[model samples]
Target: MAFLELKNIYKSYFLGKEEFPVLKGINLDFELGDFVSILGESGGGKSTLMNIIGGLDRAFSGEVLLAGQKLNHSKEASLNKYRRETIGYIYQSYNLIPHLNVLDNVALALDMTTLTASERKKRALDLLEQVGLQDHVKKYPKQLSGGQKQRVAIARALASDPQVIIADEPTGALDSQNTEEVLALLNKIAAEGRLVITVTHSQHVADSGTRIVRLADGKIISDQRLKPAYNAKVESKLQSRKLPLVTSMRNAFKHFKYHFKRNLLIIIGTAVGLFSVITFNGLGTGVKGYVNEQINSLVNPKQVLVTPYVKSSNNNQRSSYVNLTAGDKTVNTFSNKDIAALKQVKNVTKVEKIHTLSNVATSFNKKSTNITTVTNWTSVLNASSIKKGRLPKTGEIVIDKKNIAKSLTNNPNSLIGKTITLTYTGLNKSGQKATITIKVKVVGLTESSGSSQINAIGGNTIENALKAANMSTDVAALGVSASSMNTAKKVAKNINKLKVSGKLRFTATAVSSMLDRIETYISLITNVLAGIAGISLLVSALMIIVTMYMSVSDRTKEIGILRALGESKRDIRRLFTSESILLGIFSATFATIIALAVQSLANSALSQIAHYSFIQISLSNIISAFIISIVISLLAAILPARHAASLNPIDALAGE
Candidate 1:
């Protein structure tokens, strides 16, 4: 049985409906160790026959039996496997990948196998050494001369240890000296017990082989035996292995590094979108924090404010005028029952029944003035807020320093121990109206803001004054203080939900809740801004797609070389997709680092005025940015990757 048998092969081409026959019933037999040269002129079917024999063109009616096994032309997988394991093609153009060095280009064929990375590299180097181009293994195709490039191509073809080498016009572009060198290499390859089939138009080239088969007008015209086949000195054997995913990723990375400057610009464009999203989110966080700090400074976080739930019917000015008249039992107020109920709320450390007087007349040594409002002390004021004296005791008051200086005395500190007269109309316990007068000593002076006045009397002092003035000491609302801010918020939520006598009697309020609402609004606005910025990311994704498509176009021949080396379509897709993912990762990381640096710089500049570090970026936000960027980039690469994978190997090699 022949080593390779082409039994009655027939092939043709069609332009629309017109047929052009290329091969006409050609039958050939080739054995191991035979160097057969198919010599023919232009327009003959020598190349077409070579394409079929090399497993490149399977669209033909034929029995391609290798060692008695018929090649199945209808099954693409079978053709690929046969091509990968049995045949090596040497093209006239050399067809080396421009981006890859000589060593990596040679290693391309071995990547389809299970060999370790180091082993594949070692074997490729060994092949280069055998071709006498060992020192040029690290040089790219453009860096090498025509002779050296052809030698590298020969080394690549032999990297997988195929049994048959099909050379199509192998020496067509070579000078006489290089042609002799390549012919000597082919003769050596045939002597190693493998078939060497060369297709050429030169009779001089055909004479170097052991046999010459001449074709004319798509038919074999003559066959001549030049010499007996050489005996094998050593027969090469293949230890086939499967390609690892890492190999493809490494190859993809090399392509990226080859065009690092161009790819860096795309990555930076993508990073701009990521930076905007991350920075805006961080700014929202910082603004909320600043607002919360201001709120916490004004009002105690541990204090929950309580107000009466005035229904619409009693919320008119008539109800307010009645309360000021001091006999307003009709005003909705919390009774002892309500106060007791509030005291039982969870996390309530203490509950104080607060009282207030509006439009109160006060006299300091006959310097009389009507105070707009007066409040009794509660847990809301911290001790540090009192600038001069301590908190008010019974029958004592604490007024703002500015109020004392403006209203009663020129020296505010000197009035801290002086007596002041307060007169107001109120309601007694019996719900009757009367006038009240009380003399209280000032015990503290607080730092006042420009917006409001501050005058706080002791809770007991205000209650006693109201009691003696025939005014009902009915409490306005219960002031509840919790153990912590978080506990206060939780307690406030529960208290606002409480109903007394089947009607909601009180509403709970906290500084934290107001800050939370502000934070929520800020977040919504930030997200809107970030979303607008995200539109630029779509443009960046388009850039990536365009870049990848350009890469596919630029590396069309490289893609062809890989496919010809037995790379599946899936492998080709992975190669392009991996580059996209790498771009995403690089851009995301770069953007995150830039965002952090900006946050640090901005925080430093703002803290000098605000007295706090306000900018913050959370770990989850950083991770989310990375994931979103990568997902978008990978999605953009799908079309280009698929297009690259679907390129025809023959046509791709023929492209520039």
Candidate 2:
């Protein structure tokens, strides 16, 4: 049986709905140690025929048998294996990877092999020596002469130890001297018990072969054989150029090195975008944590607050006010009836009513300020904390640290136990002036609601004076200690019903309303920030698209070369996408690092400056940031990858 056989091959192409046949019933056969040259004019299907035979193109009707094993049309794996292990190819353009040295170029064919790295290196070097390129083993293709590059290509082909070497105008781009040299090398390769076939239009190349086949319009027109002496010289030369190993790992390294710089830049760009996403997410998370901490610290965790709501004439202008006076000029105030109704509700563990009076003034040697304070609930059950003194008892008062400090013209520490005179206005009885001056011991000081000590004292002290003035106050506004949240809500509802019936101006705690307002504000802020960040991510996606598009354009020729060298369409697609995936991964990793660093620095600085040990960052924020960054990167790469995979090899090669 012939060592390599193509039996009755036919191939065609289709343009739109039109069929175009390129090859018609072409039969070819080659035996071991035979140098066969196929010559044809341009557009005569020579390259297509070679491609079909080399398993690079499969759109044909034919049976290719190598060593008597029939090539199966139904199994893609079989054809791939044939390409991988049974055939070696050489091209006119050298097809040397620009980033690879001579040794790596040759070893590329053996990447999928089981040989150790050192063994593969040695094998590649040996082939380089056979091709007369051993001295250029460490040099990149761009550094070598055209002839040297073609020699590297030849060495790569031979490295596979295939049964056949298919050369498509291998010397077409060479100088006359290099052409002769490469032709001589091919002649020598066939002689070493291998089948060597060259597709060429040059008579000089055909004459050098032991047998020549000429084709016209895809059909063999002439077949001729040279003298036996021609065969003997070719055989002897091939013997001198024999290499022991067929494949090496240099290709993988070459591929990575060639693309490293560009890929690294892509990775860094992606990392920047990812970093923004991660950092912002971290900030949001940290803010949320801080807010939650503040809320918990400020409010009673087990207590639920309820405020009253009153409907105004216009639904849009709901009021918290109630009218108390009647007979044309109505007055608003909580009546005894409203309080009794609230007390009747279940879960009445302990209920305290609060009355707020504003615009109350306090004076310490003519330095006076107005304040707002709540009365009716002054004991421990109503107060949260006192920094220095106790809550006010009968005829006694607890002053704010800031007010004490301002009154004493020093820190509150100096006036903690000092007696301060407070003048209250609006006393109701005759002969008892609205202003009553009273001496009270400064008991304990308490922190204001996120207010400075001075402001807290000023505001609370003024409020205390207003509370003592007997001025009318808004009632049932603050409810403390519910039997349960549900009971408190029910009591609040009953109070509302009573005020409505009595036509009274009264307010009660509406827990749900307050919660709804708080939640709405939080959601609005969160969504707004997230939406802005999302828009930025869209821009980032566009940036990735531009980057990948540029990369595809830059590597078009390289991609074409790979496609031409027996790599399938799927392999080409995978290579580009893998590069994209690597970029995305790197970006996510870098972004996470940046976010963590920022979080750490900000948290440390804020903690030191605030002097309040309340804010903290959670692990969930870091994890969430990382995940969001990765997701964004992957989302950004999709379009670019698709654009790359959709490129046609021919157009890409032609720079179209």
Candidate 3:
């Protein structure tokens, strides 16, 4: 039996309602080790016949039998397998990939096999050497001559070691010397027990083969045998194999390297968005650290601030709770019952009542200024913030550094021991507003390093002054003391549950807890800002998608080449997605580096004023940025990758 048999093949094409018949009732038989040429003129259906035999055209009516098994064109996978293992196609136009070098183009077919990289190269090099083009292996197709390009195409065709070699106008583009060389190579392939079929319109080319069949008007008119068929020396077959995923990634990287400049722009664009997210998060962290440090220094960590939880219009704002006067009748103020409940809170060592006087007048010599005073016997006043003698004592006051240094005297120390006058107006013992004055000495001056409550008069002196004015010194809030800082947090939580008249009358908070709240607020703001930065990432993703789509358009021929080399549709998609992932990795890495450098520079510039580093990029932030960039890149490439993979191999190869 013949190795390949085509029985009564019929093929046609339609132009609207008109029928254009190309091939009709064609019968042919080909044996192994026979060099046969199908000769025909233009539009003689010769190319169509070759396409059918090569498994490239399945829209036909016939039974194609190979080695006594019927070939089913309806099953794409089976046809692909047959084409990969049995036939090799050499087009007249060379059809070499523009971006690849001679060696890679030849090794394209071997890439679909299970051979190792070194072995694939060895096989490709041997084939190139056989065609006398071994020295040009590294040169691209555009850099080669017409004959050299054809030689590379021939090498690529024979790379898979198939049993059938299909040559369509193989030597049409070569010079006389190169043409003879290619024809002689085809004759040698037939002598090695393989079928070599040539399709051409030239009589001289057909005469070189052992058998010649002439076609006219879709019918074979003459069949001549120039030489007897040679006996088979050995049967050869291409092994069935799947291309490894790592090999696909490596090939994708090579393509990336070829287009480095274009892809670098994409990476930089994506990195800018990632850098924004990372830097903003770092800035939030640094600011939180600075605020916590300042807070810890100003207030004693073991003290908890207890205030009346007067319900406010907005939950986020601090309620307006102040010290009660003699005639005041407000119920929102902390009552005696609330204070007694806080004193009972476990771990509470002592409870100190605090008083605040608003809009008071102070004078030293002829200079006077309005000041807000707090009864400052609390533990929050750090000794390091005092710039003068000591804490306020009875009949003496501590003043603000800036106020005393600039308003009353040029030097804060000069104001110490100096007599100062204080005046107050409020409801007196007669239930009417009255004024009173008292004389006091300035004992200390406090710098602006502490809170507003820290710069004030002694609580004992303030109580005495209020008594003299016939005004009430009802406590504003209580300061609860605990054995330790950790104890304070637990005591505050217990005290916060206290209530009066079935209403939440007091709220308790430690300095550490306040710092935690501030940090939480900062975190919320940072995430919101990062969310805004992520919008730019979406734009970058869009840029990537557009870029990949453009790549699909530009590399259509390359896609076709891979498909023809026996790559599955999945492999094509992997190729494009792998490129996108590489871009993501590159962009994320560069973005992290840029963000760290920015953080370092920002801290250096701010250290002069802040006395501490103010920008910190944590490891978690770096990891999140990387994951976001890569995931976005992969998502952006999905549609474009699927589009490239779904393209028909025949149409892609024919694309310009």
Candidate 4:
């Protein structure tokens, strides 16, 4: 049986909706160790015949058998395996991988083989030696002569120890001497008990083959055998070929190196957008946390604040209120009746009713400091911590740590039990001064609450001193606390109702609403800033798409070559898609690092300004940014990969 056979093969194509037959019925057979050459004119479909035989094209309707197994109409995967393991192909154009050195280029076929790196390297070197390219192993294709490049291509084809070697005008680009050398190599291949077939237009090449098959317009017109020509020396030389294994990795590394700069630029560009997104989200989280902490720090978690509402005594008076003045027509700011009513609410607990007096001054040793005074001693003292001494009694004073540290030249402990004279000037009774010579012991010293104070004075002690000095007049505001926040709020509502009924002149409801409005405005500003930052992400997506499209175009010839080397269309698509996916991964990783750096800088700046700690990035934000980047990259790569896979191999090769 013949080692290879083609029977009644026919191939056709459509030209403007008209069927154009490229190959008519054809039959051929080849035995092992046969050197056959098919000579044809241009446009005679000689290349197409070689493509069909090499499994690069399967548009023909025919039966092709190799080693007694049918090759025609087989599954694509099976054909790919056959091409990978059974046949070696040499193209006239060399088709060396531009990025790889000669040795790596030659070892490309053996990448999928079960050979070790050393084994693949050894085989590639041996093949290069056989083809007389041993000295050019480290040189890229562009640096080598046409003959040397073709020799490398031949070495590549032979890397897998294929049974049949198919040469499509293999020596067409070589000089006369180089052509002779290549032709002699092909003849030597056949002498090693392998089938060598060549498609050519050269009479010299045709005459060199043991058998000649002539094709005219895609049909075989002659099949003739020439005189036996065998070379035992060449056979022995060719059969001595051996391969090393490391060349596959070297090829992959060369490919990566060639494309590294462009890919790195793409990665960095993508990372910029991801960094913005991550940083913004991180800042939001950090700011929100800070706000919550500040609020919680100032207010007790179990406490609720309540305010009073005022109503006008007369309809005529309400009409006179054209503008909302500070002192309204009527409302009891902190009536004792309201406090009594609040004590009746459900879950009622100890409630502290206190009034504030602002801008009261205390004089000691001819130095005076301004302070705010609160009326309640027991409830206020119980809720706060005294850093030193104890809560003040009626005749004692409690000062803040700041006042002790800043004003007192003597020991704070000695000053604690010392007497200080008090003087108060009433807000209502302007220019009226009141003085009280009270022999008061200094008691507790505290850190300033909610707001800072330049001097120390306890809420209860200040109010008592004012009263003693006959400076007590109107109450500024009130503080209320209950067993729980819910109970406190209920009591507060009741107090508001009492203020409305009593028609007092002060109300606390306005202050609470003002604070709420401030919070709402801050939230609005944050959202606006976030929305603006989000626009950059969309731009990043477009950038990814453009980059991937450029990559597809740049690697078109490479994709075609892989397809011609028996890679399936799926494999071609996957290669491009994988490259894009890897780009996304790299971008996201770098972007996360950039975001963290920005966060650190932001935190440092905020700490210096606010005297507190802050964080501007969070793990969740990083995760979200990565997910968005990956999705954008995958979406961007889809169209480019499809376009790459759909490319016509013939056009791609021709363009190259």
Candidate 5:
């Protein structure tokens, strides 16, 4: 049996119902080390027969046998392996990938083999030296002469260690001198141990080979022989495999580097969108932190102020139940029973009955000030808010600077040691107003907070003063304390659910609740801003899709060359997707850099005034952005990669 044989092969093309026969019942046999030429004129089905034998066209009826084992041309995967392991093609136009250097072009086919990277490179270098293009290894196809290009093509064909070499007009585009060189190389390839087949119409080219088979009108007309075939010794061959992902990524990076100027613009455009999202998210986090800090400085974060449940006219829930004057007839004071109920709340460390008086007339050393509001001191007050002196003790009063500093004394702290007479009306336990006049020592001065109640007296002092007049000791408000800010909020939430006689009894307000509303607003704003940023990302993704499609159009011939060199459709698709993923990665990297720079600059500037970092890009944000970029780009390349993969090798090779 022949080492390679084609039996009863037939092929045709269709124009609707009409048929044009290209090959009619062809039979041939090949042995190792035979330099055979298939000679024919144009449109004589010479190329058609070559396509069938090369596994590029599987629609032909034929039995291709290698070593008595029949080849299944109809099975695509088997055909791909067959071509990769058994055949090498040298095209008339050279068909070298323009972007690849001579050495890389040769090594391209080796990517399909199960060769180590170092081994593939070494073999490719050895093959280039063999073809006498060692000096031009770094030169691209466009930089080489016709002869150099053909030599590169020869080296690439032999790189995969194929058993048979098929030269489709190997010397058709070369000068006479170059033609002689290329033909000599093909002859040497056959002489070594491989079957070398050349297709040509020139009789001179045909006579150069060891054997010639003439074809006309799709039929073999004559056969001639110039010499006997050489005997080849058995040797190891390169095994074939699918293109590896790392190799695909490397190729993608090469292409990405090749067109850096164009791709840089894409990266910047995509980065802008990602930058916007990162900035907004970071800004939201910072804004929330700043607001929480400011409010925390004014009140104790772990303390909640509870008041009678007073629903506003718009039904907005009231924040506090503190009353400053006996004129506030609307509020029901907290009895010992009510305070006990609040103490039962979970997570509550302790609870204190809160009392306050409004319109308190104070006379201190002949200088009188009408204190607009006064409340019993509790943990609900932030100690930092005390601008001077300490918190009020049992017999001491802390007066706010609002009225006391200007109207009562030159220095507010000076009044801290003075004895002040306080005259005010308080509600008795029966809910009737009673007049009270008392002397209290001023121990502390507080900042002029714009709240309704700013003056604070010790809780015991106020309760004792009320009892001295036989007035109501019952308090209008309660202050509940918890371990932490989070726990305080939880306790407040539970406090709102507290019921007296099955009726909602109290309304609780914690500084954290205000922070919650602030954060919610910031989050909603951030998400809106991020969504707006996503629109740009969508545009960037579309840009990637369009770019990949244009690449498919531009590299059509390169795709064909790879297919002819034994690459499967899956390999071709992965090649394009790999490039897209690279684009995505580069874009995300650029975005992260841009976001970080802006974060630093913005925080530096904003911190001078706000004393806070207003932009905080997290590591997770950067990572998530990269993942999003890669995923979007990969999805964008799907249709284009599939389109490139589906291209017919014959048609693509013939593409301009």
Candidate 6:
């Protein structure tokens, strides 16, 4: 029984409905250790017969038997296994992957073996050494001469220890000297217990082999035996399996690195979109914080400003004029009953009487200025804002130096112990308006801390001055203070819920309320900006798709070579997808780095103004950016990878 047999083979081609026969009935027998050369002219079906024998052309009607076992041409998996485990092909063009070096080109054929990484490297090295190209292992195909590239191709074909080697015009492009060397190498491979098949038109080349089979117009004309076949066993202990995912990833990374500059640009472009998204989110958080800092620091955060609910009477002045007896909207004041009810609320640690004396004539050293102060001393005033002196006593007042500085003196501290008088119209005990004057000593000078501050005086002094003028001493507003800032919000909520005869009587406002309002606006604007930046991400995804498609086009021959090495279509798809995902990972990682850098620089530059960070990139923000990048890239790669895997191995090999 023959080691390999081709029985009555027939093949043809078709264009529309026209059939063109390429190979006539062909019967041949190939044995181990036989260096058989198929001698024929161009287009005589020598190469087509080699394709069938190598299990690369499955569209033929024939029986290919190895040890009397017939090859299953109808099933692709069986053909792939036969090609991988038994047949090795050497093309005339060398078909080396341009991006890979000599050593990697050989090692790639061993990807389906169960060998460890180090073992695979060792085997590749051994193979390169065997081919006498050990010194050129690191060189690319373009860097090597014709003979060297052919030697590398031969070494790659032998890497998997295939049972048969099919060389289609193996020395077609080589010089006479290189051709002799390659033919001698083929004879040596046959002597090492493997069938070596070479297709050639040169009689000299055919005469060098152990047997010459001449074909004319797809029909064998003659078969001549030149020498007896050598005898040896062809077997290796190497176990084989399907290609692993790690191999695909490693190959993907190799391609990624080979095109580093182009991929880097893509990654940077992608990072721009990711950076914008992260930065805008951080900006929103920072702006809210800065606004809160300014507002909360102005007064005690635990203070809620409570005022008597003013009615529509202030607008309807004519109606007030008609109902005028002693009560009016101008003196809308909080009664003792209101203050008592506030102190009863939870978390209400303290409450103080507050008076707002607007449009009062304040005089100091023959200089007069308008006064708008909550004149009564209360906890609502941030004590840390006092520049000098202390809170006022019974006959003393604390003046805002920033507001009345020009009206008083160049140095306001000098006027701290000086006398100041305020004149305002007030209702007397008899319910008639009268002019009142209050003489008070300026004990302290305070500055505005990012928020409005008023000129303040002791509440007792104001009440006594009104009493001296025989005017009604009415309380205007109350300062509701809580135990903590958070408690202050709760206290304000409770206060607003208070009503008189089921009518809303008072409204309270806390520092957090103002902060929340400003923050809401900032958040809305930031989200809008971030959303707009997200469109750039879509553009980046499209760029990845284009890049992947270009990659598929560029590596078409490499794809065919890998398929000939028995790599499954699924492996090819994963190979391309792996590169895209790596692009996403690297892009997201670089974006995070950029975000951190911008955050630090922004915070440092603005430290002097608000002493706060205005851009705060969070961990979640980075994670979300990575997710978006990966998902987009993975989706972008799908069509291109599928197209690459769906390619015909024969056509791909023929592609330029």
Best by lDDT: 5
- Measured on C-alpha atoms, candidate 5 has an lDDT of 0.86
lDDT of 2 by residue, 410-463 (tens): 576665666565544553424254664555555556554455221122223433
Q: Write the per-residue lDDT of candidate 3 for residues 469-564, one digit (tens) a residue.
A: 777766657788888988888988787776566766667778878888999999999989988998989999999999999999999977877776
Ranked by lDDT, the better of candidates 1 and 6 is 6
Could you tell me the lDDT of residue 95 within candidate 4? Answer: 79
Residue 492 of model 4, lDDT score: 43
In model 5, the runs with Cα more than 4 Å from the true position are 311-329, 356-375, 382-475, 483-490, 501-503
RMSD of 1: 5.3
Superior by TM-score: candidate 2 or candidate 5: 5
Which residue pairs of candidate 5 clash?
307-321, 324-357, 324-358, 428-472
Which has the higher TM-score value, candidate number 2 or candidate number 4?
Answer: 4
| Candidate 1 to truth, TM | 0.83
Across 543-609, the per-residue lDDT of candidate 4 in tens digits comes to 7688777866776777767666656666666666666666777789999998888777777887766
Give the number of the best model, judged by TM-score. 5
lDDT for position 522 in model 2: 61
List all candidate RMSDs to the true structure: 5.3, 6.7, 5.1, 6.8, 4.2, 5.0
Residue 440 lDDT (model 2): 56
| Model 3 residue 646 CA deviation in Å | 2.2
Give one clash count per candidate, in the order shown.
Answer: 9, 28, 0, 22, 4, 2
Output the TM-score of candidate 5: 0.88
Error of 6 at 392 (Å): 8.3
lDDT of 3: 0.82
> Which digits, one per residue and each the tens of the lDDT, describe model 5 over residues 1-656?
69888999999999999999989999999888899999989999999998888889989887888889998877899989888898999989999998788889999999989899899999999999998888888888889999899999999999888889999999999999999999999888987889999999889999988899999999999888889987874343778898788888888888888889988988998999988988898888888887776666567889998888865556675545444454666677777788888888888888987776778898877888788777788888778767778878887787777667567877766676888898997667677878888788887777632353357887488878888888767666788998788798888888998898897779888878887888999999999999999999999999999999999999999999989988889989999999999889999999999899999998899777766798988888888899989999999999999999999999999998
Q: Backbone clash tally for model 5?
A: 4
Residue 173 of candidate 5: its Cα lDDT?
95
